[model samples]
Target: MHFEQQTPLNAFLNILFDRYQEKVPAVKKVTDALVAQGVVKSQQDIVNDHIAFRTLGVPHLGIQSFEKIFLHHGYQKRDYYYFEGKKLNAYWYAPPSDQYPRIFMSELMVSDLSEQAQKIIHRYTDPIQADPVNGLNFNDGLQIGEFFHRSLWPLPSKHDYELLLAESEYAAWVIYNRYYLNHYTISVHALKEGYNHIEQFDAFVEGLGIRLNTSGGKIKVSGDGLLKQSSTVAEMQEATFADGETMSIAGSYVEFAERLPLPEYADMPANQLTPAHRRNGFETNNADKIFESTYTGQTKA
Candidate 1:
C-alpha cells in the first residue's frame, strides 16, 4: 500500500480531528477553553503530541494489521510497551515529519484474558478472517479518514460488555468503540506564557469544570521527571447494545503532556535548542495511569 503524499498532511489531520471532535465534545470544549484563556489564537495553533487508538489482538486485527495504515504513510514504529496488568501490547510511531502528530496504538491480548472473556471477544471478532486494512485505498484521504471511525464488528450486548468489564475495562471499551480515536494529547510545552506546563494546564482545565483522571495522581511523571502527563476523565455516552438495550458508558477523552528539555539542554539558550532537546517516547508508568481515564470507576463518578 502506498500513502498519497500529494495531499497536504495538515488537511488530512484536520479531517481526522474534525471527525473526532464531532464525536468527542470534550475536545472542542478544552480547545475552546484554551483559546478563550488566550493561551493560543485558535485550535490550529495548538500542537498535538500524539493520538492514541485501542484494538483487540485477534486474527485480521491488532497492532500487526492496524499499524500498516500509518506505516504506509511513512511513520516509523518506535518503542514497544507492554501493560501486564492491562494485558496490552503497544507501540509508538514517529511521524515522517514534525508537521504530523505521533501515533500510539495498543491492542488487547485476547488470549491473556480468562476463557469467558476470550470467548466473548472472539464471538465478535472471529468472523473476520482476513485483514480489513488490506481492502482500503490508502491514497484516498476521505477513505482513510472514514476507516478510522468505521465500526469493524457488531456492537456488544450490555450483558457481554459488563462481563468483559468485570475483567478488563479496556476490552469492554474496544468492543463497543472499534477504531475510535481513544485520545489526542496536547503538547503543553508548546503553549506560550501561562500554559506552557502541564501543572498550569491542569489547573486551567479544572477551572473550566473538567474533571481529571486521578488514578495514580493528577500528574503522572516519568522516573527521571522530564516527562509529565495528565488527562480529563472520559465522558460517558449512552450506547445502544446488540439487544437494543441502552446504557451510559465511557467514550473518549483528552490528554495533556509536557516533555521537558533534557538536562544537557537546561543550560542552553532558548534559540539554540531543537526538537531533539526534549524528552521523546512515552513512559510506561505514566501511561499506566493515563489508561485508567476510561475505567468505569474513573468515568462513572
Candidate 2:
C-alpha cells in the first residue's frame, strides 16, 4: 500500500499489482476511464477495497500455504466463508493498517469434489511434498513476489484441463493460473459524491463498454444492504496447453465495491467517515456470485 518506501511488504504488493495490471487489460481500462471522467487524477487516487486470490485445496498448497506471505506481512486473518455449491472455502484478512487492502483468499475443496476431479488436481499437486512458502526467504520482498507467479507444478494437459473444467471451473483456473491475483477492487465510496455510489459507478463503468458479471444481477447487494459490489467479466487470454493445443481462457478482472456507512454511522457526514464507519468484511452470498466473474457463464454471457 505504501510504495513511497521500498519496504519488503511494499515491494511485494507493488509487484503483484504491477504484474496483475499488465496482464489484465481491464485494470488499466477502468482506471484510465475513471481519470478521464474526473473520478481521480491517477490510479493512486483510488482506494483499493480489497484484492483476491484463488488456490487449490490440496496438501501443501491451499490457504494454509498461500496465506503465509500476507500473514507474515502483518495481515490478521478474519472471517471465514464456505461455498457449499461451489465446493470451496475462503477467508478475508484484515490488513495491518487500513492503508492496505484486505485479502480474500479462496481454495477449491478438492476432497469435496468428485473422485475424478480430485485425481486430476492431485496428479500435479501431489509432487509438492512440502509447502513451498516455507522454503522461501520471507525477508526479501521481490523473492516473495516472484513466488506468487512461479509455477509449483507443470501445466496440466488440455484433456485434464477440460476434465476439471467439466466439474469445477475453479480447479481448471488454478491449475493454469496458480497464485496469480484473481482481482483487485476499486472503492467506489471513496470517489467523488456523484460517483461514490454503486448505481452511478456501475452505470459509468457500463457506459465505458466494460462488461459486468451478471450472475447475481449486474450489482450484488448484501442482505444487510451495506456492501454493494460488481465486477467486469474476466479478460480472456489465449492459452497454449501442455499438449500444444490452445484456447482462449479466462484471466483476471476488475471489481468495484461501494461500502455504505454502517447504521450507527449513517448520520455521519462523508468528510468525517472512514473505512471504520463502513461495512467491514465480505458477505458469503455476494462473494458466491462474484466468484463467477471468471466463470463460463459470465465470460460467455
Candidate 3:
C-alpha cells in the first residue's frame, strides 16, 4: 500500500486512529473531524493492543527534507531505533500532543555490492526507462527488488556470504531504476577493525556506475562524533547509469537508539484510603479472610 502524495506528519496519527475505530472508540471522535484523506486500504491485523501498516518503498529526498515536511505537519521526531539484531531501522512519531496512538515506521534495510557483482549489474543497466517519480527503472522481468535485501543480512557462513555479495550488483541494476537511492553501510563490528571504511565505500559505489551524493549525508555519517581530516589516497570508482545518471554515495551511517522502560505507574495508579477507614464499615484488604475462616481454623488478625 503506497500513499500517492507525501503524508502530512501531523495527520498520520489521526489516520491511524480512524483505521481502528471499532476497537479504539476513544479515537473516532477526534479522527472524524480531520479531513485528511486515505490513499491505501487498512491492510493489517487490527487488534486490541497493536496495528501494522505496509510502507511505500520510496526513498526520502533527504533527512532535512523529511524534517521540514514532517515539522510543518506538527510532528517532531520523538524517537528512532536501529535494530542491529534484525539489521533494520525504525522510528517513532508523536502526534503533537493532539492525536492518539502515534505512529511508527520500521524494518528499514540498506545494501551494497562486491566487484564481481558489479560486472553482472552492467548487463541490466537501463537508465532510459528509470521512473524519475520513484527513481526506479520501469522495466519488467528484472525482479530485482526482491534480491536487494537478500544480501543485506549476514548469511550463515562466509562462503554463502560471498555468494550473495557477488550477486548484489546485478540486483542493484534492476532495482536501481525503481528506487532512487540505495542505502549502504558497513556493520558496527566491521568498522571497529578499520574494515570497509567510508572512503572505500565511495570508491565501491562508483564502480557500480553510480555517483556518491554526499551533500545529503543520507548515506554516510559516523555514529560517533569523530572528525578525521585525511589526505590518504582514496580509491575512485564511477556510478554512472546508462542514461547519464552518475552518483557516488558516501558518509551516510546509521546508529541504533537505546531502549527505555514503559510507564507502568501511570497506567495503574495507587490507592489513597488511609488507616482511618479501619474503624468504619471499611472491609479488610484480604479477599479470603471473609470466607471460611472457621473451616480453615484461622482467625482474622
- TM-score winner among the candidates? 2
lDDT of 2 by residue, 1-301 (tens): 2366788988888989999998998888888998898888888888999999999888888999989988998999999999999999999999998889999999998989888988888989999999999999887999988998998999888899999888999999999999998999999999998999999988988888889999989899999999999999999999998899899899999999999999999999999999989999999999999999989998988
Better structure of 1 and 3 per TM-score: 1
The TM-score, computed over Cα atoms with residue i paired to residue i, of candidate 3 is: 0.26
The C-alpha RMSD in Å for every predicted model, in order, reads 2.7, 1.0, 24.9
Flag clash pairs in model 2: none
- Model 1: runs farther than 4 Å from truth? 1-12
Residues 1-301, model 1: lDDT tens digits: 0123547344456667776778778788888887777887777687889999999999999999989888888999999999999999999999998767899999999999999999999999999989999998777777887887777888999999999999999999999999888888899888886788888989988988999999899999999999999999998889999999999998889999998899989988755666689899999999999999999879876
**Positional deviation of residue 114's Cα in model 1 after best superposition, in angstroms:** 0.7
- What is the Cα-based TM-score of model 1? 0.95
Q: Between candidates 2 and 3, which one is better according to lDDT?
A: 2
